[model samples]
Target: MSMQQFAGGNERFIRRYEYDDSWVIAADVGLDEDDIDVDIVGSTAIIVADTGERVTETEFELPSAGDASIDIHNGVLTITIQK
Candidate 1:
């Protein structure tokens, strides 16, 4: 597992996981907003405000290939396996 802290008051956590193939899971996002948005670009993903106020991008290295889901709480974001 790896972690990175943003200068703009946001943090990210990533873990190497393999389900069907191989996947990288990214989570632990701290956003000061009501809603959150996500953008997936290959192995990289971006998180931002739904109102286009601010944006934070995080990169994850996948193990093989898998899917993920973003969990939200009090403007905090956490990524988990998509079921």
Candidate 2:
């Protein structure tokens, strides 16, 4: 699961995209206050702090074939999937 926060028009839930080198998961994610961002880039997930920058991005790993799920709670974000 990955969490991100941006100072915008009263919008707490952030957006996340699961992608690979050649395809995108075509999904939007909502973030909460206690969510963590995981860098699942090619099978690597980590927790990162909220860097109040213009744009924040990381890579995501994809399974052989499955669906991706994004969870939104209290302005935090969490992503999960199975291989």
Candidate 3:
């Protein structure tokens, strides 16, 4: 593999897409559910992961004041927002 392939920490930890009336975010959060915390303050969603070695925090603004549904599967954290 090329050295460039390992850029962005091997892969992007976050993926975001917009729907007609909503937005979806899928993130690679390898930590256990107990180590992950999500919170919506105003129009921003915050994600914090404590992986023993480090603490990673991510935040994104929601499209308007939408509602969000969050879940985790196979170490993937998914958030769907409805407008």
> Model 2, poorest ten-residue lDDT window?
20-29
lDDT of each: 0.49, 0.43, 0.73
- Candidate 2 per-residue C-alpha lDDT over 31-82 given as tens digits, one digit per residue, 9 for 90 to 100: 3444446545444434353545433554444443344354546545555555
- Error of model 2, residue 22, in angstroms: 24
Q: Once superposed on the true structure, which residue ranges of model 3 sit more than 4 Å away at CA? A: 1-10
* Winner by lDDT: 3
Give the alpha carbon lDDT tens digit for every residue of 26-70 in model 3: 777776678899988868889898988888887777656668888
* The candidate that achieves the highest TM-score relative to the unseen native structure: 3
Per-residue lDDT of model 1, residues 36-68, tens digit only: 676555545566554466554445443322376
lDDT of 1 at 78: 54
lDDT, candidate 3, equals: 0.73
The weakest ten consecutive residues by lDDT in model 1 span 5-14
Off by over 4 Å in 1: 1-34, 50-64, 81-83
Q: Sum up the clashes in candidate 2.
A: 10
**Candidate achieving higher lDDT, 1 or 2:** 1
True-vs-predicted CA distance for residue 60, candidate 2, Å: 3.1
**Which TM-score value belongs to model 3?**
0.70
